[model samples]
Target: MAINLAILGATGAVGQELLRLLEARALPLGELRLLASPRSAGRQLQFRGETRTVQAVSPESFEGIDVAIFSAGGGTSREWAPIAASKGACVIDNSSAWRMDPEVPLVVPECNLEAGRARPKGIIANPNCSTIQMVVALKPLHDAAGVKRVVVATYQAISGAGARAIEAFQEQCRAAANGEAVDPGPLKGQLAQNLLMHWSVDEASGYQEEELKMVHETRKILGDESIQVSPTAVRVPVLHAHSESLTIELGRPMDAAEARTLLAAAPGITLVDDFAAGAYPTPLTAAGTDPVYVGRIREDVGNPGGLQMWVVSDNLRKGAALNAVQIAEGLFA
Candidate 1:
């Protein structure tokens, strides 16, 4: 059964990845519409061996569309998601706008695809990129041992910021290599050979918005509001993929071997946990990949009975575009 599809923010980074996944994945396709802001209206994108010109988004863009994937910013999603839903399209929005809305289901297909089926607002949200990968890695253990608390420190990539941030980082790197002064564009400070906690901060909570997303979004996706999440999100100089060091406390006492067995059999996870050989998942290993890579599964020495691990995934792929496409696949295909 072929379905008509519309991609909002078609000229943006995640939107372009959505186009590539649509071509590579098994989504029965009908008519495809590429939409963006008026500035990107005339630009052409290549898909399925044909050139598709992007059109400016408007009320009529959702007409006859079955599933609309919104990769634009939250403002655009807040404005257009309901409009798209009203026109009978199931909207999968990748933004912070609707994830916390009780009416909208925040979905990571592997973890909560069924929650997506009962969307009261007809909008399904893609979780924060950082949250998406963390939840995916935690789901299997969570189900097996009941996750009680998580302390996560994220090393996020510049690509997670946006396409422009990537260019800025590259330029900064070049400048640094030449012993020249650096310019931080779309970033607070130099990201080349540097680290930053650059996400918007809530002065009251003293937590960056990115870190807070992990806190609330984790509870929501795991369907346990009582679960505790302590997060610290930092930006690294990496070009792609986000990495996290997680210290998890579970309900029951589970050793590293037991956790490894469960994760090895879980969906959307690839284990590279040969610690003796110094093998562990890393940003470079996960870039351009779809699966959440987990390694260094060990009992937390400090906590005595808790678990620790390293997780990594491409922020743009599994973290954003690929996750949205997977939700659409589960719902429509």
Candidate 2:
């Protein structure tokens, strides 16, 4: 059944990717609506070989919308998601607003597409971008060997911050090359040649909000509250595709070759593991791609029974827009 759909925050980075995926993917489509803030109204964007003008979203904009995908900031989602849901749209949100909400299901289609069917509030929360890639890589392992703990350190891309952050990083790169002062516009500090742990801080736990999201969201999506996740999220000097080094402890001992075989067969995963030949996934290679690239699979020698691997994916694609689209596809199509 073809359905009517709307994109909230349609001019932003993830929103733009959503448009591209809608054009590229096979989603039964009836009507497509592009929406944004009042200031962005009248802007023209190309879709399905047609020009669609961005409209300043109003209550009536969602009147007949079957699904509303939001990539705006948290405040916009908190304010508008429910409104859209009330107007008969299944709201798939790409912000932190409803992620931890008990009433809302935080979903990654590969890990838990079934959780999306019982949306009491007519809203499904997209898991954090970092969380989305990690869980997708690990879920198969968890199903096969029962994952116990995960210690992850992320090398995230600046594009995860926003389009403005990408522009800022480029400017900082030019300045660094010229030995001029680098100004971090939305990034807060020099990111041209430097790494940062700059997501919002939680005063009590002292963990960046990004790290905390991995810990909790991983548990929620995997349906295992006892699974421990220690995460360190660092913003790296990359343009797209977020990468992570994960050390996983499982219930039963699983060797590298076994883990490799499992990941090779997992859905939404691309295995490029042959480290002896110097093949592994990287941000540059993963840019503009969909699959979560998994490589460098090996046994954790220190932990004896644990495994270690590297994961990378286009944060804007699988991490945000594509995941939301997949949810709507599974639910409606």
Candidate 3:
């Protein structure tokens, strides 16, 4: 069956990716509406060989739309998503505004598809980029050995901040390469030859808001409030993909070899643990890919019941665009 679709933030990065996927895939669509702010209203994007002009989104945008995927920002989602929902569209929001809402389902299709069936608020929240890959890998192990606590450190790409951040990094790189002084915006210092290891602190928890998102979103997605998560999020100069070094403590001891077998067969996860030949998952390897890549699997020497692994995934794909589209598809299923 063909369904009418509306894409909010059509000019944004994730929004553009969603358009590409919608064209590439066999997802049936009745009419596709590309919406953006007034500034981007006249821009044109190609889809299925047709030039579609973006329209300025309004309350009436969702009138006959079946599913609305939003990637604009929290404010837009807060102001417009409910309005779209009220008009009978199922909204898949890719913002932090409603992830923690009791009524909204924060979904990662592979992790929790059933949770997405309810739309009491007519909106489904997507998890943070860092949280998505971590939970996807943790889900299988969590079910087999019971995850108790997790210590994760994420090296997030500048792209996670959006297209402008990547542009800023490029401008800085050009300046530094030519031996010129530069003022890099959106980052503490020159990101070309540096790392923002300590991200801005979240006033409430002293941890970065990025880190807190992982801590809180993980527990909610896993459906286990008791699970403990300590996250340290850092900004790297990379253009794509986010990498995490994870140490997960399980209720029962599981060997690295055993965990590898389970993860190798898990959905949306690819086990790449061939350490002897210098093979391990990295941001470069995972970028532009959909699967969550896990490698460096071993035991945490400090804890007998703990397993250590590295997780890498495209921050834009599985982390953002692909995930939203997956949630949108679940509505049809």
Candidate 4:
């Protein structure tokens, strides 16, 4: 049955990707309503082939909608997700608002598809960009060799911040080309020619929020509190894809060849680990794809039972909107 659907924050990057992927991914679609801030009211965005006007979201906006996919900020989601849920629409939120909530399900379909059934709050939370890609790559290995600990560092793309930040990055790059001082928009410094040790600061924790998201969300989705995670989230000059360097300690030694074989057969994983051929997943190559690309597979000699790998994916796709759509479409699957 074709049901009514709404894309909250339709003007934002993730929301816009949801619009494109609604038909590109060929997920179940019905009457598509675009909802955004009042500033975006009357703005028309092309979907599939038709033009749809984006509306300002209200409590009543979800009345006839069967599903609401929200990519608006956390505050917007905190205020409106319940309102949408109370209206009878199943919400798949792309914000952090409801992720760790006891009532909501934070899901990564490949790792915890069954958790989708536990949404008493009528809202499903999408995992963070870094967590989504990391877990997708980690799941296969974790199942094969009991993963004991994970130490990862992320090279996050600016798009994970937002579309405006991406524009600011481009502007900075242009200025750099002209030998001029670059301007930082939402970021504290120019991300064009620099790297930041921290992405989103969480002063109390003394760690980047992205790193914390990876640690907490990994444990939640994996359902393994024993899986110790230490992460350092860094922001690079890349425009779109999020990449991670992982060191996974297993209960027993698993050689690189065996790890490669397992990842090769894992769902949603594309293995391109041919160091001899000089081929591997890079942010430039992974910018607009679905699969979480895994490579740089090697055995950590220091710990015989450990393996090291690199994971990359389009943060907008698997990390946010596409993961939300995957969970939403699985309702029909």
Candidate 5:
């Protein structure tokens, strides 16, 4: 039987990418439901050459949905995801709403597919976009070498915020090129030519919520309560793709070549580590790609057991929509 699917946040950045992936992957769907906020209701979207009108999300929206992929913000997921699950739909939520909830299993299929099935709430939480890619690249090594600590600094894309944020970055760039004063409205400051250390909503703890999500989500996905994760999330001017510079200290000694070998054999990871050819993973290269790119694999000079590497991925795809879809596919398979 073909799965009946519903896509929440159908008009947003991640939502749009979800639509593109669904088309590219040609998921077996008996019926596709596009759902959005009230403001986006009645709008038409093209899916597989068919025009489908988006409906306002509500409790009744999940009546026949076998699986619901939520790219909507946390508020929307908090309000509607449980309702969808109650209506017998399995919800793959791409929001912070239920990620830390004990009942909702936070998953990166590459690392924790079994945990996804262990969810009693019928809701599976997708890890933060940054966390997802890092874990995918790190899991194989962690299993082989036993990762003890992780330090990650992210160079996130503007699209991680939303389409409006992407537009804001573009407008700022165009204005700069034309020698005009650019207003940074949605982003709160100039995003095109500047980098901001703050990535997401700032919490009272001084760490932006995105960074905190990474620290917590990584631990959850790895099932390692003792693994220490320190994160610094930064918003770069890039339109798509998030890149991370990671340094990991393992419980056992492992050299760069061994780490590279382990990472190469891992699923959903691509090694782009030929610095001699000026070949390394960049945001521009990672944009629109589904796999996580790992490069600059080497030993950390300061720490004997530490390995440093670069990880890049399209935040909208593997980080959010595509990962959620993959989880749903895992369930179906």
Candidate 6:
């Protein structure tokens, strides 16, 4: 039987991407429901040459939904996801709402499909966008070399913040090109032609919540209680794709070539390392692509048994919408 699918946050960036991916993959479907907040209700969205009018989402929206892919913010998921699950719909939530819940499995299908099957809450939480690509690239190495620690610096795209941030970046860039003053209230600083270490507001702990999510989510996905992860999340002017420079400490020495071999064989990972030919994965190259691109594979000079690599992926696609849809596909298949 074809699965009946519902897409929450249908008007948002990641939500739109989920529609494109479903169309691209021609996923088996009995019915396709487009849901959005009240503000977006009555809007029309195109899918597979047919225009579907969006309906305001409510608890009743999931009545007959076999699978619901949620790309809405945490608040919406928190309010509606359980309601959907209560009605027998399996929810693949893209927000961070239920990731840490012991009963809600944090899934990255490539790393932990078994955990997905054990979702007692009927909800599976997709890891943070940054965490998803990082874990996909690192999981192979962690298996081959036994990762002990990770230090990551991210060049995150504005799309991770939603569609408004993307528009803000563009407006700021246009003002800069015209030599006009631009207000940076949306980001609290000049985002055009600039970079900032603070991706989101810092909590009382002094670490931005985005960074902390990486630290905690990575440990949970890897199922390693002892692995130490430190992350610095930066918001770049780029509109799509997030890039991370990661240094991973292993329990044993690892040669660069061996590391490359392991990463190349891993699922959902694309190897793009060829520095001599000026070929390395970048956010520009990874944008719109589904696979996590890995490059700059080498040994860390300062730490014994440590390796350095670059990971890049489209935050809206692989990081959010696509990953959530993929999780639903896994369950349905």
- Expressed as tens digits, the lDDT of each residue in 86-150 for candidate 4 is 99998999988888998888898888888888789899999898999999998988888778899
Q: What does candidate 4 score in Cα RMSD to the true structure? A: 1.2
lDDT of 3 by residue, 1-333 (tens): 788999998888788778877887767889899999999988999998999999999998999998999999899999999899999999999999999999999999888988999869999999999999999999999999789999998999988887677788999999999999977686667889888865557777788888999989999999999899988888888999999999999989999989999999899999889988899999998887789999999988999868999999998899999998887776673
Give the whole-model CA lDDT for all candidates, comma-separated.
0.93, 0.94, 0.89, 0.88, 0.90, 0.90
Please give the lDDT score at residue 246 for candidate 4.
Answer: 96
Rank by lDDT (best first): 2, 1, 5, 6, 3, 4
lDDT of 5: 0.90
lDDT of 5 by residue, 174-244 (tens): 99889899897788888777898655666678888888888888888999888888988988988899999
Per-residue error (Å), model 2, residue 127: 0.5
Clashes of 4: 0
Q: lDDT tens digits, residues 1-333, model 6?
A: 699999999899898899889998856898899999999999999999999999999888899999998888899999999899998999999998999999999999899977888878899999999999999998999898788999999999988888877788888899999999987866767889898765565668789889999988998999998889988899898889999999989989998989999999999999999988998999898999899999999989988668999999999988998888778777785
| Candidate 2: 10-residue stretch with minimal lDDT | 162-171
- Ranked by TM-score, the better of candidates 1 and 3 is 1
* Model 4 poorest ten-residue lDDT run: 22-31
Clashes of each: 0, 0, 0, 0, 0, 0
**Ten-residue segment with the worst summed lDDT in candidate 1?**
11-20
Candidate 2 accuracy as TM-score: 0.99
4 or 5, greater by lDDT: 5
How high is the lDDT of residue 319 in model 2?
Answer: 92
Of 2 and 4, the candidate ahead on lDDT is 2
- Displacement of residue 217 (Cα, Å) in model 1 is 0.7
Error of 3 at 289 (Å): 1.3
Kindly provide the TM-score of model 5 when superposed on the true structure, using C-alpha atoms. Answer: 0.97
Better of 2 and 4 by TM-score: 2
Scored against the true structure, residue 253 in model 3 reaches a CA lDDT of: 95
Q: Candidate 1, TM-score vs. the true structure?
A: 0.98
Compute each candidate's TM-score over C-alphas.
Answer: 0.98, 0.99, 0.97, 0.97, 0.97, 0.97
- Of 2 and 3, the candidate ahead on TM-score is 2
